[model samples]
Target: MAHYLPTIGFGEWVTTVGEVVHFTGYERPLDTLKLADPRDVKLGHLLGTADMIAQMADRCYLEKCRDRLYPEFVLGGVALPLSANGDRAIKYASGLDLLRQTPEFMMETRKKRLDQTFNQAYRYIEPLFDGTNPYLDAIERSLDFLKQVLRSESWRLLRRNPQVFAAQPDSMTNVRGLMVGYFKKVWSPD
Candidate 1:
């Protein structure tokens, strides 16, 4: 959930980035859950490792959203909010409306903005891992793949069948494998 916010539009967080970041436990530590008691060390380690793996899976799902789901929604005419509503504002335009209004510049600008936002959001979750964050690694890999998709002549195929593109080598299966492999290495029931 927190990882997804990085890909969110600026309009979505104009006034609430702090709240969103805080609510996502951006600065919090999982170490707080570690028990001081000696007997519970093993259990605590297992639980913490499990939580980390879960976060990694969450990151993989977010990548899937960026690579596959978002295009579906946009092409499908799924309405999305373009900006935060003000107290005095009676109505607001959808993202599609904004695009339709200014197709020439909006698409490129929007993509840049979304990419920047995603990077900023990634920074928030980064410190939680102290340089060992699997979720951040997953997002970086997805972003690299996304860059390739945008650069090549294959974007149309991606738009037509995202599921296929999503299933490629660095897709969810590999992400899962990374998480599972990490878990196996870090946690052992001795």
Candidate 2:
């Protein structure tokens, strides 16, 4: 019976932690992630951590590039009255009002960052697996699937009209089914 950290809401958990500590202002998580006795840390924990990182990268790819951050960028910026640390609102961009990048460009930039982040995180834990790392393969497959999704008509439609959910409820069902079915096919063992 291998124990693994539950990955559900893992991205939001990380985001909350960052917000609480004012991004890059804390090191406790890094310092305390591993047990004092290295041997006491199970392989499952290492794998789970890497998997969670990959999932986080995926979430960031969507949120930062497609769904949230990009839209905020286009609309001036996030509407937070104060910074995460409760100080004045941080000007995250230079001449934010003058910036005009397309969603496609944002997605490409974010996908590159996602690749770097995921690869580095997974590389740290790869040595423990002795060359048979199914998680890495799964992550690659997921990236490929995401690429396909980005080119899909459903995704384009949603991007064009973020309010599609309210306008046509069945569209959500189609998107959900597409995601679920593609993941099942790619992840299932042959």
lDDT of 2 by residue, 9-124 (tens): 35534533333332121234434443444433333234434445454345234322454443343244242235668654533332222122333333443354324322333456
Question: Residue-wise lDDT of candidate 1 within 80-170, one digit each (tens)?
Answer: 3233552222121332233223322323322442233222233344577885656546645644544565456254423422334554766
Runs of candidate 2 with Cα error greater than 4 angstroms are 1-28, 42-47, 50-132, 151-190
Which lDDT value does model 1 have at 146? Answer: 46
Per-model lDDT: 0.40, 0.41
**Model 1 stretches with alpha carbons more than 4 Å out:** 1-63, 66-131, 156-190
Listed in order, each prediction's TM-score against the native is: 0.26, 0.28
Model 1 per-residue lDDT at 31 = 39
Q: List the lowest-lDDT window of 10 residues for candidate 2.
A: 92-101
